[model samples]
Target: MTVVAPPTLAPPPPPGAYKDPKASAVASRAWRWLWLPLLILVLVIAGASVVFIVDLDSSDTGTLNPHSYRPDGGNALRVLTEQYGTPVDTPSTSADALKAGLGGDVTLLIPDTAPLSVRTIQSLKALPPSTRVVLLAPDRGALHVLFPDLDFGDFPATSPVAPNCDAPEAKAAGSIDFDGAGYLPKTIHAAHVTSCYQGGLLLVSDSTGPEFALLGDANLLTNEHLTGYGHAALGINLLSTHSRVEWLYLDQPESASSEGGDGSQALFPPWVDAASLYLILAGVLVALWQARRLGVPVPEPLPVVVRSAETVEGRARLYRRAGARKLAAESLRGGALARITPALGLGADPDPRALIIALAQRSGRTTQEIHRLLYSPPPTDDQGLLALATELDRLVDDYLTQLTIGRAGADQGNNPEGPQQ
Candidate 1:
């Protein structure tokens, strides 16, 4: 008996089912080589981050803090003063410095006043007359805030220059790092402003505010240059003359007006956060507009019909490609059993034991053997799966033939008038 599959037309599977086996193999191979590059990229980024942090901590830039061990830091000064029984207190903000330097003899030392705001400068200027305020490299804005009449002027190259006149700190250091910008007062307040460098004074003391000392250059205060010439002596005499030193390391201000001249642009840049929000909102709206359903789908007839033989061949190829021999074997056995059960006059949901018993009795085969063939573990390979499918078909066809012959013989017996033509 022959079991031939007829032509059958059915809808194609969903798009996801049509994956190419070659493409999957290529993707797996690509990942094998690609992971190394990704790892290298990550390592490169990490190395760059480490270098940036190191560069930021370097003392060549103007950053003075006792906590920092960088070349520009005041760690040496801080340690020296502590040894001499003078403790240095470092404050981050202007308000904190004022509160710390409330005593009349306290010296408020500002390493870099470029970061100070108009508000902080005003607050610093309001300190007591007895409390000395030391400023290093005060810019135009700072000079304007501290000394309203003083103007920035062109100065000669910094050199080891004498005090030339009697100022106690300058005379003590003898020669110092005086190479920097100078201040030119609109009106010569001779008693108040004392010029030390050349044309403009390296150190200035204004009478309007506290005993404010304005030094031209900041390099002299750094850890690298502190030991050069009279730098250390100058720094110590200038800062540690008082009992306590209030070190104010004013970083960039938080408020907009303190940074950019234009308040609106500094506070809220038009192209940054605001633009990003608008872009995100626009993208969401576009997605919603495109995704909205217009109407229900209409069913349409397929353009071409695919034969069952071709479909079966395609499915077999797919199963082999996926290494699905076991799945293929199970499907074939199930199909054979479905056809055979009905031929034996059994219901669709007949018990498996009963069906096996009926098949065994009719074919004169052992119940165990029939059960093993009908409901056994799936085949391990493609050759084994093909053999199982052929065996199932032969067994089912033979049983069906026997059942047909038995029905014919029973009809002849009931009529008793011989076989009807």
Candidate 2:
């Protein structure tokens, strides 16, 4: 009646107890160095962030900004305009510019980088006839917004040209820089347009609307080029004509509505759409023509029975007609090796030396004879090829006969009784 104690099972060995030492060392080394790459990645991201922040801060002083002090900024021109007794109002948005223009006798300075909305265009068109509007480097889209009858013409001259026109502003600011687009009038309204600086500057004094001045280049007003030639005089003359100037300064690009009519489709020729449709249709037709397949393969019986021996003989005759003695010798030798290697218990790709040794041992032939019969150069003529084929057949037959005798002898020895005593 004694209490018996139960035997406890041994605790399981620690995890990965049987893992290979090499694999364990590799895993340990991997984990130990894992933090190095992570540290590098973090430093790279931090460095990139610092660079991006510096660039972003520098970008605030952009081109055409009236208050920007950078070389590309228009701060100098703004100071000159103010010094001429005309106060400049910096407006970053189109709405603010239009609102500023509401005051009596204000000049609206629109840079090419300013985003023009339809509402802003219409509002500018409705301004008082006395309010002057100056457009700097206006592209075709902006021109269409203001003057539907005008488009960009030939490229402007690279060198500065004289202001030969009779316009009072061009006459006063003689020999201004003209290194941008030139204008061409498309309709009868061309009569009202006065061009200066070789068509680089245009003044449209339409009796029915406000006076418009188009400056083909923005470089003329930048701080870097303001003092060059008569650029300062031209900028001050155009902008200071009114008592107040509304300068549009855009820090970032604004997204304009599609109604502004700057679509890429207008750039292509009229026949492009039709040609694209025809090409697409032709491609589809070609794909269908090539992809159509006949019905699944149909297996049929041969009309006549052909033996394997006949097939081999036919192939041999073809080789002989083609004068392929080397190829014929190779085939005969390869067939002999294929049959003998398996009977000798050698692998499909046994070493050449080992195979020659095994063949010599089994057939009682010299290694040189076996090697020559198997690995010698191909025959040069039909008679040599025939002799080589005969030798290969004899080698294969002798190997097989030796293999049969060895197996029969082993079987008799294992039978335990004397053979038919």
Candidate 3:
């Protein structure tokens, strides 16, 4: 009996079979992410270029050259955030200062907006028990809960100066040419330091509740501003004097900061750990080998990264097309001989077959002596190269004598003695 045919169900349409206008709009909007951040970053950086130029060329900014910045120590903020333009606060401490005289807690704040972040609050709260709070620019009514008795001495934000440290750092302190220029102004009024509170940071110390030493200027830290500014010397003193120093580089816009370093002595790279002597030797060898090779010259310190497999693959394609298999084989053979012949102390250009014959002759080896080893056929494919290696290894024992003296009687020694009597 014949069966009746049934109708088949149609499959559901593929995802988004019909492009909804809303969905299309969303997809189009998503593509903007590919370039929007980059475009905005370019614009921002371009705009920031002016600040950089001002920091570099203007007087009272560059800390490296005495003429760049006035000897006034008051505008430390401008020196930090505007002058040198380095991300880290240059007014804080110098490396030498850190080693020579650094002492006590180093507190700093770069503030923005009225509402302090909870994380910042927690970090400030977590200061060591013996630390003191140092308010750079404390805004009135903003941190009333934290600093009720803060001494606001109404210090001026800036002071006039020559191209060097012109005054004592404090009433009792001696001034040092922190920047290249010898002139460093005496302590500017601390009010400038308190101003950062208007922005966001409230650098607090656990030891000193209210009367902490305040540095009003951040100009010493900016990359463009600090070069000629006495910023460098000021930092050195702080760093040298402090027992333990911490650098918290805050990204004001992001309300985030990162550590320049934590306590650690080893500056070695991770690759220094070698598993064995061979590994250590190999690593050293690789480095030495690389150092000797003069690759493409680069103006900067950045390395020239290469993909070996890709390069080889490209070369291999060319080789295969040109049918240079025989030439390739000869080149490999020459290399093998250079290594093997010298190792055995044989003639520099000793033929493999001739060397084998000489070994057989010295030991009085019969035609049947290791016949399989000597007469083994070369493989037909690319694997033929392996046969040459395997046979060479097998003959090394019989040919040792040939390498040292001369192979005159190796074949007889290796031959099966007539009957084993």
Number of the top candidate by TM-score?
Answer: 1
Task: Please rank every candidate by lDDT, starting with the best.
Answer: 2, 1, 3
Q: What local lDDT score does residue 216 receive in model 1, on the 0 to 100 scale?
A: 77
Model 1 segments more than 4 A misplaced: 1-61, 152-158, 185-191, 199-208, 256-421
Clashing pairs in 2: none
Model 2 TM:
0.47
> Candidate 1, overall lDDT?
0.70
Of models 1 and 3, which has the larger TM-score? 1
By the lDDT metric, which is better: model 1 or model 2? 2
Expressed as tens digits, the lDDT of each residue in 321-393 for candidate 2 is 9997766766787678778878666777676666776777778677667767877667788888989889988
On residues 1-421, what C-alpha lDDT tens digit does candidate 3 reach at each position? Answer: 1222222323323333322222333565586665787888899998899889875665343222212335433344333333333333333222222222124344333222133433343344344433333333334443443444554433332332222222223211222122211111122233323222121212222332322333444444344444444545544333323233233222232232322232121455555554456797999999998889577977875377668898767865675577654433343344433444565446664544454444455433433332333333323444564555455454554446344444233444466373365
